[model samples]
Target: MKVLGSGQYRFERVESWPNVPKYFEMGQPSDVAINSSGEIFVLSRGKHPVTIWTPEGDFIGSWGDGMFSATPHGIFIGKNDNVWIVDCGAHVAMEFAPHGELLRTLGNKNSASPTCEGRLVHAQPFNLPTNLAIAPNGDIFVADGYGGHKVHRFNSKGELLLSWGRQGREPGQFELVHNVWIDSRNRVLVCDDENDRVQLFDTEGKYLEEWTLGNPSGICIRDDIVYFAQLQPFEDKSNGRGSGSISLYNLDGVLLSSWDNTAGGNKDTLIGPHDLCVAENGDIYVCEVYGWRVSKFRKIQ
Candidate 1:
């Protein structure tokens, strides 16, 4: 079996671990998350949209048809098994039950902030909202997405408390705030895509620090390790196959290791790693945007 990563982070690739129902096709899997009971929840742009599966590759169920927007973006299974999803085309991040019951909605429906202005006008909760992160207290943090240059924080009851970030090449500013994740210390981590960096901040939206990395598209923090997926390759000569790579970091933001190969955009091992998450048992699941598939990597300690 093919393997990626080294030493403590080593993982054996598991090909075709998930078996969706017959004719269960999707355009591109946006994001994937595993719940406590080992069930996998996938966000896709398929006919059925949201689907669930058992650990043994059996199709358990699927739901959320004709409900989401034109495009499905991200999924994060959070506290109490609440399923959180983002619809960039519709510009909203909503909470839902496992059976596709709508619980709460964060952003305004079908509303968006003007993006081409090349700067942030103000804090508008709507406009291509991408991903979601839940704090220990149930407060939600949203990445206002490439369409809006800001990060939004809302109280548990869906009240907008604060919004921060702007458009600029300066340290505190952001070009495309793609995703957000709250770490063990409750520190907010934002994947600033177009800027090619990850900016750290306090829950109050205060800039803390930033780290230069390849076009980071998604972020997942588990235990003491931080895992981020690289955006798809576009440039003719990308540095170190800049796209389709997964890099690991420590809680202190120190570079630990990276999983990429060869050169000259040689990508057969890992392609278009849009979103990913490490399971409790150390397995890794990746959702892709260009490759139109999801990958599973088993930890081989």
Candidate 2:
């Protein structure tokens, strides 16, 4: 198997992982989240909307066939192993029980929030809530990305409590607010994707600070470190053929370790890594958009 990264962040790519069911056709896998049992939950826009796999990448089961939209987006696993998903096409955020039942939904489905054509994104609900993050107290924070340049906060009961963000190059603004993560400090860390930065904020929508991370698409917080996937390097941002990589940083935003499978190297390349999950054993799972594959990177530290 080909290897990627070095030092403490080293990982060996398994040649074949995640075998889908028979007659399955996937254009591209969207995102992934690991449950408390270490089982991987993958979100897709394909025939199988959600699939479960063992830690070794063995296919276990599948669900949510006709229940999702044409374009499935981010997913997050919360307490009691409940699954939270966002459908960019349907323009709604939902929470589902682990048993594949829909527990709750936010925003009106199949409805599009208004936005100008020339804008990169706008500040409004239902425009395109890309992903979500849940606080320790069970509040939901969503990154209204793609067509909407805002973040929405909701109570556990699905009430829209607060929302902030706008399309701009300024601190509180966003170009493509891609993903959201609630760190151990209970702060909201947003991946301002197109702006090449990660903006930080208090739980109550107060601006704190921001860090320059090139074309970040997703963020994962395990232990006290923050792990984020960059869709492409800063210089390659506009090209669309991004050399994707994942980077680890301290909660203070200090760089620690990074694995670049892009660049000129082809060993276990991670192209357009949209979302990632870290297992309790440190194994890293990455889902790519154009690559149409979910690759596993076993930790060797």
Candidate 3:
């Protein structure tokens, strides 16, 4: 067993995690979220887009067959156990019940806002929206990252509330607005990927703070801690072959610990870690697009 961290935030890679059915195939697993009962929901760009499994890696079932575009970017399970899937290729976001019932959808399928051949001309609903986070009151915050640089807000019923962001390195602007999350204080945390920082804002989109965390591709909050899955590193962002790592911090942006997956050699290496979710017990599930698998890191101290 390969260990991947130290101090209070150590983890051991589960070499045999997520035992899939023999005939099943996973095509670029991108994101993961754990429901109320601790069931892990993985969103992938594959024949079966949504796959459910126990925390112990036992396969439960699957859903969303033929219901998504070729690229599904993110998966988020709200506090109420509603599943949200951001279809990047389709330029839409969908919400489903815990039992796989289609609840509602945001944006038009295959229809993105006006863009100049994949470049953002203006801020709008979605031009390849990446991820979403639900506030305690059910407000939806989406990161319209790819094909556009913007963050969109919506009410519980999926009505467009507002949108903010542009293409820049400034505070409110985003070079690549990737993942988003709502913390205990209801503050909005956005992963500005290319900017090499995570920007903080109020629910109304007011810029408050920013933290330098190399190429943060995914972020999640567990208790008083913030977990970020960094995609490679800032220096290696363009090359796409550097080892990404997981970093933990306090709510106030104080770095607690960081784990470099490559420190344990090739077997424990993580490539293109796009998303991650921390279990209640502190175990972490990471989704890698390039690695094409969801690997578990069991908390060991």
Record all residue pairs in model 3 with backbone atoms less than 3 Å apart, i.e. clashing. none
Model 3 agreement with the true structure over 15-121: per-residue lDDT tens digits? 76799989888677989999999999999898999999999999999999999999899999987898999999999999999888998889888998874243454
> Higher lDDT: candidate 2 or 3?
3
Give me the runs in candidate 2 sitting further than 4 Å from their true place.
1-3, 115-124, 233-242
Residue pairs clashing in model 1 are none
Off by over 4 Å in 3: 115-123, 233-242
Please give, for residues 84-126, the per-residue lDDT of candidate 1 as tens digits.
9899988888889878899988777778766644465565676
Off by over 4 Å in 1: 114-121, 235-243, 261-266
Better of 2 and 3 by TM-score: 3
Clash totals, every prediction: 0, 1, 0
Give all candidates' CA lDDT scores: 0.80, 0.82, 0.86
Give model 2 RMSD, 1 decimal.
Answer: 3.1
